[model samples]
Target chain A: MKLTVLYFAWVRERIGLPRETIETDAATVADLVEELRGREPRYELAFADLSALRVAVDQELADFDAPVRDVTEIAFFPPMTGG
Target chain B: MAVRVQQEDFDFGAEADAFAEGRADAGAVVTFTGLVRDRPDGGLREMEIEHYPAMTERAIAAIEAEAVSRWNLVDSLILHRYGRLRPGARIMMVATAAPHRADAFAAAEFLMDYLKSRAPFWKKEVTDAGAEWVAAQAEDEAALGRW
Candidate 1:
């Protein structure tokens, strides 16, 4: 499946891009993270601490265990500091 | 009820009046505005707020719905701004209306609490020294436990 992955805040800064299109067979968000981590050192560093990050699948908040199959977009960022 | 995420600033007085207009049953209206504050040293030049456009509206809508249900609110409005803002600029505002003061106040606080930690907006402060992202506070997350 083709997925459009997005990064925000420091996650985007660390990864050096705001968004990317990935063709992968990973079935879950955790799996996709591992796949991306293997593709480059930047991914490894940015995702080094999953506890510091939050994710959304198809624009809705979801956990790392959330399945990625049949999903079109995934966004990764730090805990929000909004008001 | 309305939830709006925009890049432009809003008028607080006009919005407040409109929110309460024609709602004779509503005896109380509460509002909270968040502004960009400079550091104590006063070197802060600007604040750039970034948000997930696709999700911001939906997330705030869900929050508004919850507040309305919990407090039996007559109406509510949430306006959050993004992009560049100078110090003292308004960043966001939340207004709530209910039949009584307690429900209006509590619901407004609840909206602010959830909006602070749950909404997908992030703030980056740029100063004469450098640019830095605002870190999320542990206290903000813990505040959710009360609700």
Candidate 2:
């Protein structure tokens, strides 16, 4: 499946991009993170601390173990500092 | 219910009046606005707010629905601005209306608390020194426990 991954705030800073597109067969967010981590050093560093990061699949917040097999988009970012 | 995410500034007084006008059943209306404040680490130049365009409006709408589900609210509005904002600029606001003051007030607080941690927006403080992303507060997450 093709996926559009988004990064916000510091995650975007570390990853050096706001959004990206890739094809993956990873079944869950954690699996995808590990896959990306293996592809480059920046990915490895940005995703090194899972506890420091938050994930949203298809725009709704979800856990690392959450399934992403059928999702089109996923976002990774630090905890929100909104209003 | 109204959920808006934009880069433009808003008029608080006008927004409050617009929410309450001609609504006889809503006896109480409450609005909370958050401003950019130069504080503990004060070298303040401006703050840049970043948010996920695909998710911000939906996320706030879900929060609005949650507030309505938990309280007896007549109507609700959430307005949040992104991009660069100087000190004292309005960053966001939430307004709630209900038949009683308690419900209105509680619903407004609840919306604020949830939006603080749950919304997709992220703030970066740009000071005279440098620019840095603002971290989320532990207390803000803890505040959710009350509801």
Candidate 3:
């Protein structure tokens, strides 16, 4: 499956890019995180603490354990400080 | 219901008036405006707000729908600005109209609470020392527990 992953705020700064396309067989958000972690140290550092981050699958907020099959987009960012 | 996410400032008076127009049944209209506060030292230069453009609209619309359902609101409005803004600039606004003051006020607060924690926007404050992304406070998340 091909997925478009987005990073925002400090996560984007740390990861050095805003978005990317990755081809993977990962079935869950966690699995995708592991795949990204194996790619390089920057991803490992950006994803160092999953608790400090949030995930959205297909633009809707989802848990890390959420399934990712057939999902086209995924975004990861720090806790929002909006309003 | 109206939800807007843009990089431009909005007129509060016009928005409030427009929200109440033709809604004679709504006896009360409550509005809350969020501003960019300067640092305590008074050296803040600007605030940069970043957001996921596509997701921001969808998220605010969902929040507005929840508020409408929970409070039976007559109408609701949410306008948030991104990009660079200086101190005293309006950051966002949430307005709610209802038959009574309680519902209007409550719905406005509920919208703000959800917007602060659930929305996709992130704020970074720039000061004379440096620029830093504003961290989400625990108190903001705790505020949602009351709802």
Candidate 4:
């Protein structure tokens, strides 16, 4: 499966890219994270602390254990500071 | 319901007035404006707000829909700004209208409570010394439980 992954704020800063396209057979969001972490040190650093991060699969807030089989988009970012 | 996310500054008074204009069904309207506060130490330079564009709109609209349904609001508006903002600039505004004051006020509060953490916006504080992303407060998340 092909997925477009996005990063925002410090997550983008740490990952050194705002977005990327990856091909993976990962079934869950956590599996995808693991695949990315195995790619390079930058991804490992950005994903080092899952507690500090949030994920959105297909533009909806999703859990780490959420399935991503048909998901086209995934975004990772720090917890929002809005309003 | 209306949700606007932009980099341009908006006229709060004008927007609020327009939202309430000639609405016979609504007797009470409440508006809340959020502004970037200047640091007490006077060391802050600007606020850099970054957001996931598509998700920001979707998330805000979803929350607005929830507020309208929960409170039976007559109307609602959410306008948020992104990108670089100077201290004292209007960062965002939320307005809610209902037949009664209680519904109007509560709906506005609910919109605010959710917007603080649910929306995809992230704020970065820039100062003379350096710049840092503002971490989301735990209290903000806990505030959602009140709903």
Candidate 5:
């Protein structure tokens, strides 16, 4: 499936990119993350610590185990602190 | 109920007037305007806010729905702005109208707490030294637990 991924805050800083479109065979959010992590050293470093990062599927807050099949987008970022 | 997420500034007086305009049943109106403070913890010079477009709106809508379910509110309005904002600029607003002050006040506070803790928006502060990402405050999480 084709998916647009977004990174924000420190995650964006570490990754050096804000958004990208990727085609992957992953079925879950965690799976997709691992796919990205394998593509480059930067991805590995950016996703080194999953606990500090948060994921959202199609713009709704989601867990790492959430299914990603047919998802149009998946965003990864640090925990929010905005009010 | 009205929810607005925009880049432009909003007029509180005008918004409040429109909210209470033809609603005679609304005996009490409580509004809270959150401005960009100099420092949330006395450790900042400038702040940058970033948010997920779809998630931000979904989260706010869910919070508003919760307020409506919990309070006997006649109407409610929520306005939040995105993009770079400087200090003293309005960040958000929550206005609730009900038949009594108690419900209006409680609902307004509840909505603010929810937005602060649950909304998926990240804030980074830039000081003279460097920039640092802000983390969710324990106080905010604790406030949400009270509900």
Candidate 6:
């Protein structure tokens, strides 16, 4: 599946890229993250601690275990604190 | 119930007037406007807000719905602005009207609390020294847990 991944805040800084398009065979969000972590050192550093990061699949808040099939976009960022 | 996520600033008076117009049952109206502070603890200069297009609106709508369910509110309006915002600029507003002040105040506060902790918007501040990303406060998450 083809997915557009977005990184925000400190996650974007650690990853060095704000967004990207990737083609992966990963079944879930966690699996896709692992694939990215293996591709480069930056990905590993950015995703070092999943607890500090939040994920959204197709613009809805989601967990790492969520399925990624048919999802066109996935965003990763620190937890939100806006009013 | 009205929820508006816009890039333009809004007038509280006009919005409140519109919300309570022709509604005699709305005896009390509570409005809360959040503005950008000139200084943060970290010496921040400016705030840059970014939001998910579809998700932000949905989240706000859910928050408004929850507030409506919890209170006997006559009408509610939530307006939030996005993109770059300067110090003293209006960031958001939440207005709740009901037959009494207690319900209006409670509902307005509830909406603000939910928006603060639950909304899916990211903020980055540019200071004279450097740029830093804001983190979600544990207290905010705890506040949501109460409801």
Most lDDT-accurate candidate: 4
- Tell me the docking grade of candidate 2: high
Residue lDDT tens for model 5, A5-74: 9998889888898999998889899999899999889999999999888898888889999998889989
TM-score of chain A of each: 0.98, 0.97, 0.98, 0.98, 0.96, 0.96
Sort the predicted structures by lDDT, highest score first: 4, 3, 1, 2, 6, 5
Of 2 and 6, the candidate ahead on DockQ is 2
Worst 10 residues of 5 chain B by lDDT: B38-47
lDDT of 6 at B34: 92
Candidate 1 Cα deviation (angstroms), residue A23: 0.6
Better of 2 and 6 by lDDT: 2
- RMSD in angstroms, candidate 2? 0.9
Q: How far out, in Å, is residue A32 in model 2? A: 0.4
Error of 1 at A59 (Å): 1.0
TM-score of chain B of 2: 0.97
Highest-scoring model, DockQ:
2
| Cα lDDT tens digits for candidate 2, B1-147 | 999898999999999989999989898999999999986766789999999999999899999999999999999999999999999999999999999999999999999999999999999999877899998899999999999
Q: What is the DockQ of each candidate?
A: 0.91, 0.95, 0.93, 0.93, 0.70, 0.74
Candidate 1 is graded, for docking, as high
Report the C-alpha lDDT of model 6 over A1-83, residue by residue, as the tens digit: 78999987788888898889999999999999999999989999999999998998998889999999999999998888789
Displacement of residue B46 (Cα, Å) in model 2 is 0.5
Measured against the true structure, the TM-scores of the candidates, in listed sequence, are 0.98, 0.98, 0.98, 0.99, 0.90, 0.91
**Per-residue lDDT of model 2, residues A1-83, tens digit only:** 99999999999999999999989999999999999999989999999999999999999999999998889999999999999
Q: What is the lDDT of residue B110 in candidate 4?
A: 94
For each candidate, what is the lDDT? Answer: 0.94, 0.93, 0.94, 0.95, 0.86, 0.87
- Considering DockQ, which of the candidate structures 1 and 4 is the better prediction for this target? 4
Model 5 lDDT per residue over B21-134, tens place: 888998999999988777756666766788777778888898999999999999999888877777788888899999999999999999998888678778877777788888
